[model samples]
Target: MSLDLPDLRTDLETLAEAHGITGAVVAFAAGDEVAEAATGVLNSRTGHPATTGSLFQIGSVAKAWTATLVMQLVDEGRLDLDQSAQSVLPGLALPDPVTIRQLLAHTGGFEGDVFVDTGRGDDAIEKLVALLGEVPRLSPPGAVWSYNNAGYVVLGRVVEVLRGVPYNQALRTHLIGPLGLTRTATSADEAILYSTAVGHAGGEPVPTWSLMRSNDPAGSSLAMTARDLLTFARAHLSDGAGVLPARLARMMREPQVTLPDLGRPSRWGLGWELQEWAGGTVVGHDGSTPGQAAVLKLVPEAGVAAVLLTNGGDPDPLVAELVAPVLSRIAGVVPPAPPTPPDPPLPFVVERYAGRYVSDVMAWEVAGDDEGRLWVTVTPLGAMAAHGGSQTFELVRLRQDTFVFAQARGGVHSAVAFLGEGERARYLHTGRLNVRRSL
Candidate 1:
C-alpha cells in the first residue's frame, strides 16, 4: 500500500488552486515510508514557492502535545488525573471542582476561550490563569464536553510547576527536542528561523501571524511542517516508542467523554477527537488561528497517518476531500463523511429558541427569520469583537433539542443544543455553554 508521491504532488497542486488556498503542505505516512507534497507559495508578496519543509501554524493540534506531556507526568507519579486542578495550581480560581483529566478531556466546565494578553513575561500563564477568577463557570466539572483552551493553558502551568521550567522550554526538553522535531517551534520568533508560511485572510497576507504569547500551550503559538506534525503523530501511532510509554499513549486515545454536538466527532479522548469512520476509528485534532488551518489524522487500524497544514483560505473541505481519498487509496481505509443535517430539516418551534445567550468571549442572539426559520447571530464580545464583528446562520433542526449551523465563511458546521423548557430555556450549548440572558 505504498503512496504514489508523484501523483499526490500533482493532485495537491490542483486542489490548492481550486480551493483558493494560497499555500499548503500535505504529508502521509504509512509503515516507515512518508510522502509529502507542497503547493502554492509561502507568501504571495514574496512569491516564494512553498517547499516540503515550510512551517505552518498547527494551532490547537498542539494540544495533543500538551496532553502527552501531562500523561508523561502522570506516568512518573507527579500528576494525578483525578486530582482537583486547585490542588495542582493553588493560586488559580475556578468555580467548579475541575480535575486534571477533565481539563484534558475538555469537561472542566470553565469558560474555555479566555484569550488574555498577559504580556511576554515568564509569568504570562500564571497571569492568564488569574484572569479566570472573573469568568463565570459554564457547568459542573465533567458534566459536559466543550472545547476548552483555557484548560490546556492550565495544564501548561501545571507542566511548568512540576518541571520547574517555562511551558515552551518544558515542551522542547520533554517532547519536541527529544523527538528530534528540528523544524517545530513554540513561538513566532523561533518559527522565523525556519522556512515559515505567512498566513492569509481573504486572499491577502495577514499582518500578524501569531496569537497572544500566553496561548502557546493551547496550540495558538506552535508552528511546524506537515511532515513534522506527522512525525509527532507517528509517535502516538507507534504507541509512544521512544517518547511516551506504550500504556499512556493508548490511554490518551481512549474515548473519555461523549461530545454533545452531533455535528462534531461523537466523542473526545484526553486530547484527541475520536471519530468512528466507515473503514475504522480515526483520531486526530484540527486547529485554526487568524488565517491558518491545520489537521492531523491517524488511522490506527490502517497503520496510516496524514497531516495538512495551510495558510489562509478554508482548509477544512480541502483536508477532508484530500485526506479521505488518499488514505483510502494508500491504507485501504475510507474515512467517514462528516455527518450532514437531515435534508428538508425537521420542524421545531422557532420562538422557543429565540433569546440572547451570553458568555465571556461571545454572545448568541437566536431569532426567527421571515419564513419562521430559526437563525442565530453570534457577536464576538469585549476584546474579541474588534477582530470579528458578528456572523449569522440559519439553524437547521437535527432533533428536538439539537440544531446545526453551517457557517458560510468556511462552509463549516457546528451544533447547538437548547436546554430548559420552551420559554424558560436557560442555556445554548455550542463550543461552550452560553447562558441565556433574558427571555
Candidate 2:
C-alpha cells in the first residue's frame, strides 16, 4: 500500500486565514513516512513567518508525556500505579486517599483546575501539593471521572520526588533526549532559543507567554513543533517501540474510565484519550492554553498518527475539514462529527437540568422560559473572566440529560452532560465536572 502526502502548507494557510488563526502547524506519520507544514505568523506584532519547525504551545498534550514518564518509573519497579500519592510525597494532604493510578485516570474526584501560581522556584510543585489540602473534592477518590489538571500537577510532583529533580529536567533525561525531540521546549527561556509561536487570543497577541509555572506538569509551558509532536506520537503507535517499554505504551492506549457523552473522547486511558471512531480505535488527546490549541489522534490499527497545533482560533472546523480526510484515506478512521441539535429538540423536563452549576473558575446558570424552552447564561469567574467575558446561550437537548449550544460557538458545537440520577442532576460534565449548587 502506498501513502501519498497532501499539500499541507497550502491547506494550513487557507484554513488559518479562514478561521482567524494567527498560525498553525499540521504533521502526520504513517509507518516511516512523515509530512509537516506551517502557515501564518508566530506573533502578529512581530510579523514572523510561521515555519514547519517553529514551536507552538502543545497544552494538555503534555499530560500524555507526564503519564509516559510515570509509566517508565513503573517499568523500572521504582513506582507502583496503585501506590497512594501521599505515601511518596510526605507533606501532601488530600480530602481522600488518592492513588497514583486514580490521578493518572483523572478519577481522583477533586476540583482539578486549581491554578494558583507557586513561583518558578524548584519547589513550585511541592508548594502546589501543600495547597491541595484545602481544594474542594468533587467526590470520593476513584469515584468519578473529571478532567483533572491538579491531579497531573500532583503526578508531576511525584515524578520530582522519585527522579530527585524538577519535572522539566526529568522530561529531558527520561523522554525528550531519548526520543530525539530537539524542537520541544519545557520553559520560556528554552523556547526563546527556537522560532516559537506566541498565542493570539481574539486575534490579538497575548500579554503573557504561558500560564503559571506551578501547573507545568498539567501542560502550562510545554511547546514544540508539529513534526516534533508527531515524533512523540509515533512513539506510542501500537507496533512502534523504543525508549518506553512496549507493554506500558500499549497500556496507555487501553481505556481506563469512560468519558461523559459531550462530543469529547469516549474514554480515558492511563495518560492518553481513547475514542472508538469509524470502526477503528483512535488514541490521543487535545490541549489548549490561553490562546493556543492542539490535538493528536492515532489510529493504532493502521499504524498512522496525525496532529494539528494552532496558536489561536477554533481548530474544530479546520480539523474536520482537513485532518479527518488524511486519517480516513489511510486508515478508514473518521473522527466523530460534532453533535447537531435535533430538528426539534427532544422534549425536555427543565427542572432536571436547570440550576446553577458551579466550578472554581466558571459557572452556568440554566433556566427555562415560559415557552418551555431552556437556556443558559455562562459566567466566567476569577482568572477566566480576565480572558473572556460571559455570554448567554440557548439550550438544545441532544439526549437524555445532555444539552448542546443551540448556536455553534467558535465553529464547534459545545455541550453539557448532566450526571447522576433523580429529577435534579447532581453534576454537569462539560469536559470538566461542574457541581450543581442547588442540588
Candidate 3:
C-alpha cells in the first residue's frame, strides 16, 4: 500500500476547515515510523497555531489503555475474566454476577454513571459505588451489553484494591511509564504545560473534566496528545512497543458482541470497538467529553492507524472525513462510504401478531398498520418500528422483528426481541421484561 502524503494532507485540511476546527494535530503510522501533520489554530481566540505536539483529551479512547492494564492483571493471574464482579471486589457488592471480561467489553449489566466528574481520585470511585448501590441492574449479568461508566468505576476500585496503589499511579506504573508517554496522565486536574483544549456544551461552559476526576479506567478522563494516541494505537497493531503482547491486544480488539442496525453494524470488543472494514478488522475506540471529541482507529491487517482530536461540539463527522481518505491512501483500498438506507417499508404480514401478551413481568400490545407493518405499543408506551413479521404472528421466524433502542450517540440502550408464532410471541429487552402474546 502506497500513501500519497500531499493529497492526504489536503483532504485533512479540507475536513478541518469544514468542521470549523481551528486546530488539529494528526499522526499516522504504518508499522514503521510516525508520519505526522497539523493544522489550524490550537487556540482560535488567541490565534495559537496547532502544532504536532498539541495535546487534547483522548476521551473514552483511554479505555483501550485501561483495558490493557486489566489484561496485565489477567496475564499475572490476579484477575479472572470469568469470575464474578463480587469475587474481584467483595466490598463493592455489585448487584449482578458480572465478570471482569464483561466490564472490559461492556457486556455487564452494571448501570452507567451519568454524573461526569465525581473527582479524580479514590473519592470518585467511592461516589460511583454509592450511586451504583441504588441503581438497579438493567439485565442479568452477561445477558446483554450496556456501556457502564459505573462499571469502570468498579474496575478502578478493583485495580486500586489489588495493586494497593491509586488507579492513576497503577496506570502510570503499568502503562504510561513503560510506554514513555510523557504527555499522558489519568488525572485531568494535573496542570500540564502543553497546549490544551477545553470542553464545552452547546458553545456554553459545561463541567470541565476535573469536575468528575475518576479513578475509573473506562477513559472518562485521560488527557493525551494526538501523537501519543497514534503511538498507542500503532503499538497495539503490531505489538511492537512490547507494552502489551499481541495476543492481549487482539483480546481487546476482538468483537465480543454484535451491535447491528446502528447507523452502522459494529462490534464491541474488550473496551474497543471492532468493525470489518476493507479486507480486515478496524479496531479502536471513540471518546467524548463536554466540549471535546476524539477517535483512535487502527487497521491492523492493512497496517495503518490514525487519531483525531477536536475541542468543540461534534467531532465524529469531521474525524470520519479525516480518516477515510488516509485509510484509502495507506491501505490501497477505497472503502465504501456507508450508504444511507431509505425509509423502511411496513411489514407485509403484520396483522397476525396483533394481541395482548403477558410475560413474567411485562405486558404489551401488538397491532397491524394499514400498511401491514407490526407496531408494538408496550404497556409503558414502548413503541418500536418493526421490520419483519408474519400476519400469523411468526415474529421469531422473522429476523427483522428484533429491535435495538440506543442512546443519542448511537450507544445501544436496550433491545426488544419478538420471536414466536402467531399470537404467541416472545418479546424481551436486555433479557428482562419478557412479553408474550396473550392467547
Candidate 4:
C-alpha cells in the first residue's frame, strides 16, 4: 500500500485541472502507509499555493468532531445518550422531549437550520440555544431523520454545559488537542495564522470568510489540513489513542437509523454518515462552506481512510477522480455511481408529489404542467436568502416519491423526495425535512 508521493502529487494536480478545481488537498492512508498531496491556490486573489500543511474549511464535518466530544462525555458516564436534551440543560425549552441520541442522529425534529449570529462571545451558543424556544417543532421528536444544524448547536451547548467550557474550547481540549492535530484551527482567526485556503465561488473568492460564531458547533469556523483530518480519522481506526473510548468509536459507526437514498448515505450512525460500497462499508462525512467543500471517507474494514479538501470550482468530479482509485486499490471499494437520469424521462404520479413544502429558511413548490412535466421551484427566505437567489429545476422520476434533477448543478444531480401516501406528499426531503404546506 506504499504510495509514490511525487506521482500522487502529479496525479492530483492533473485531476484537479480536469475537474476545474481551483485548489485542493488529497490524502489517503492504508494502515502503515500514508500519502498526502496538495495543488492549486489558497485564494484566487492572492494566489497562495495550497500545500500539504494548508487548512481548508471542513464545514459540517465538524459535526463529527462535536459528536466525538459528546461521545467522550458519554464514555465517562457524564451523559447518557437516552437522556432528554432538556434534562441536561435545566431551562432549555423544547416543544417536545428530544433525547441526546436524537440530536446526534438528527431526529430531534425541531426547526434545525436556525443559524443566527448571536455574537463573538463564549455565550454565543448559549444564546442560540435560548432562542430555540421560538423555533417550531417540525415533527415529533425521534420520528424522522433530517440534517439538523441547529440540533448540533444544541449538542454543542450540551457539551458546554457538561464539560463546563465554551463549545470551541471544549472541542480543542477534548478532540483536537487529544488527537495531536497540530494543524487544526478552531476559529477563522486562528486559521489565518496558518496557510489557510479562502473559499471561492465560480472561480472567484467568496466575500464572506466565515459564518456567525454562534454556529461554531455546527462547523462554521473550523478548518484543518487534509493530513490532520486523516489523523482525526485515524483516531477512530486506532481507539482514539486513550482519548475516545473504543466502544464509543465503534458505536459511532453503528447504524442508528436508515436513511432514504437521496444519492448520499444509506444510513445514519451517531454522527457519521454510513455508505455501503461494493467492497464493504464506508463510514464518513462530507462538508460544504461558503465556497469550500470537504469530504472524509474511511474504510475501517480495510484499515483505509482518505480526505479531500477543496476551495472553489467543481469539486464533485475531483472527488471521484481523486478518491476512488486509492480506495479501490487498497480496499477494493467501489462508490455507488452518481444517479443518472433515464434515457427517456419517466412519468410520475403528479398527485403524489405536487405540493408546497415549507420550512423556516426555505420554501419549495413541486408542480406538474398540462404535459405532465415536473418542475421544482425553491425560494430561500430570511437569513438563508443571502446565500442564493431563487432557482427552478426540472425533475424526472427516479422511483416512487423520488426524482433526480434532470441536469446536474454544481457537479451534482441533486435528488428530491416526497414522503407520504396515496395521493399527496406529507413531507419534502432535500436533506432537511420540510412539511407540506406548513408555515
Q: Stretches of candidate 2 above 4 Å error?
A: 238-240
Local distance difference test values of all predictions, in order: 0.85, 0.87, 0.63, 0.87
What TM-score, computed on C-alpha atoms, does each candidate reach?
0.95, 0.97, 0.77, 0.96
lDDT of 2 at 238: 46
Q: Give a tens-digit lDDT track for model 3, residues 104-131.
A: 7777765564454465456676566655
Where is model 4 more than 4 Å wrong at Cα? 4-6
RMSD of candidate 4 to true structure, Å: 1.6
Compose the digit string of candidate 4's lDDT tens values, residues 155-213. 99999999888998998888777777899888877998999999998889999888888
lDDT of 1 by residue, 235-308 (tens): 99999976899988999999999876555556899989998777678889999888899989998877789999
Off by over 4 Å in 3: 1-3, 200-211, 332-339, 347-439
What is the Å distance of residue 314 in model 1 from its true position? 0.4
Instruction: Report the error of model 1 at residue 50, Å.
Output: 1.0
| lDDT at residue 95 of model 1 (Cα atoms) | 87
Model 4 lDDT, residue 252, Cα: 91
Q: How do the candidates rank by lDDT, highest first? A: 2, 4, 1, 3
Q: Which prediction has more favorable TM-score, 1 or 2?
A: 2
